[model samples]
Target: MSDTSGSQTNITDGQQVQLLERVSVAVVTTLPCCVFLFINVTMLFTLRSKPVFCETSRYVLLYNLLFADTVQMALGHLLYLFAACRLFLTYPVCGLLILLACFTTTIAPLTLLVMSLERYVAVCYPLRHTTIITIRNTGVAIVVIWAFSSLNILTRVLLLLEFPFKDLESLQMKEFCSGVYVLLGPRSKDYDRAFICVLFVSAGVAISFSYFGVIIAARSASTDKASARKALNTLLLHLVQLCLILSSTMFDPLFMALSGILTRIVFVRLYRVLYIFISLFPRCLCSLIYGIRDQTIRPVLMQHLCCGFLKPAVSNSK
Candidate 1:
């Protein structure tokens, strides 16, 4: 009897420990997410506050990129909270969340692709850049990116026809809500892998090409050395950002493979760490990179970030 009682106590203690750890992880992840969301929102407002940002082609593209990333970050964080809380949402609800998440996730790389090409044009053909990258074209490009991503989402929804949700006792999911559970069919998996591969590879090649083009342009006698250098740095940053964004998509499969080798406790701990780095960190990169690097945006972003305190001083100085 004493042995059985001791075992029960140990099990209860272990469960409590797990619960505490889960809560701790959630708090740690969420605090940074909230901070980034605040900064991103401020940056978005800063972009729209000035006429120059609205009129410029690159700023327009940056707005689109940042918008998609902000949505992605929010959805991803919400989904993470859902999983952390062990909430099993119904299929329809989960599907909507997952689809929205996937849609925004798809936009990041594609936007980066467009932004890279924009930089390439700016550096390689400075005279033609203004004509080629106009407001109308930027708007059209954003529409194309959204339309393409919508097609992918539509295909995934169609693939759901194969899932026999009718066989289940309820629409409520048996497991925690996630892309892995939501997309169970073989075709969905194959399609997802193929689509991700094609999208990332194309973006990678385009960005790389733009990087090289900028490097070559930098050496030319006619090229503005400073502009070429800046474009090179921007392209390089885009490549790094692309890789970080890509890492979030790859983490699930990698973690799944690691699950077999690692114990549950270790796996959960490692997953949280990777989740912070892979998922959360990448989403914040856009604001941090452009907010600090872009001279035009820095002062406005700072003013907004400081809650307009700098605005009065700047006006007084002016």
Candidate 2:
């Protein structure tokens, strides 16, 4: 009887492990990779097909934002897929992935900041907006944003390198991926938290102010109520996008803190599920929002989807 019970227990444990692996691979790896790839490629095609759409300053900025999001998905979530599949990555390769992820993640919020400011100028100072938010200036702003974000992440990467990787080989052998599990000293951890908090707060404040300015301008422009209402709706959409992007970043430290306190298997599983949803869902949401919400892109997207899917059937019938 004792031997039978022990065997049953072992079988149960094995089944549970297999189930967890399957779930993780599906949610974290396969679904996100396919969704991100499809959305980003579709967005690029839609945007690039029209020269006039690409020439507009607002769409140009949005194109850059989409580009940044695509890079972020590639560097961050795509690597999560590799990790989910239990692929082995070298220390240098892992570090480089981390650096690229950090760089792209940082660029996203800053690009949104630029977008908000562009909207602010367009709504508040319409007469000067053409001069202020021209394609050349927008291009310069993108360059500056990228340069700043890259430098910030480069510093963090350097700081990260100082941590000992003595057990990295053993860890990789066991887990088959690094999984962003670098151990930082207390001071280093504190600095990281501080940096993240500051960045979040600063960007959040700037976005808020830009939206507020747009609102004020809208209210004052009594002659152009229709345009004001449209601008307001667009700003609201942007706010939703902002929240989704922030959801990916803001929840991580909190989850890390919870993991330290609640060290249960269930808690770990819940965290994995939540992380997969929060991180990957936003990329899909952002792409969908842009494709559906943008006047210039929406028709183009519909046309492409219709032709891509229906043309094959029509051809076969002929």
lDDT of 2 by residue, 1-318 (tens): 999999999999998997797576556556656766687778877778877666778777777788878877766665656555557766566767766776777787788788877877777777888898888998999899899888877677677767677845453433333323542455556666787777777777877887777667766734266665766676677777777777776555566568678866766577667765777667667767877866667767766766565332111110
Q: lDDT for model 2, on a 0 to 1 scale?
A: 0.70
Q: In model 1, which regions exceed 4 Å deviation?
A: 1-19, 311-318
Cα RMSD for candidates in order: 3.0, 5.7
Residue 43, model 2: Cα distance from true site in angstroms:
0.8
Largest TM-score belongs to which candidate? 1
Error of 2 at 310 (Å): 7.3
lDDT of each: 0.89, 0.70
Q: Give the alpha carbon lDDT tens digit for every residue of 215-287 in model 1.
A: 9888899999989998999999999989988888887678778989999889888888888789887888778
Model 2 spans with C-alpha error above 4 angstroms: 1-24, 27-29, 82-90, 164-180, 221-223, 258-265, 307-318
Q: What's the TM-score of every candidate structure?
A: 0.91, 0.80
Tell me how far candidate 1 lies from the true structure as C-alpha RMSD in angstroms: 3.0
Best by lDDT: 1
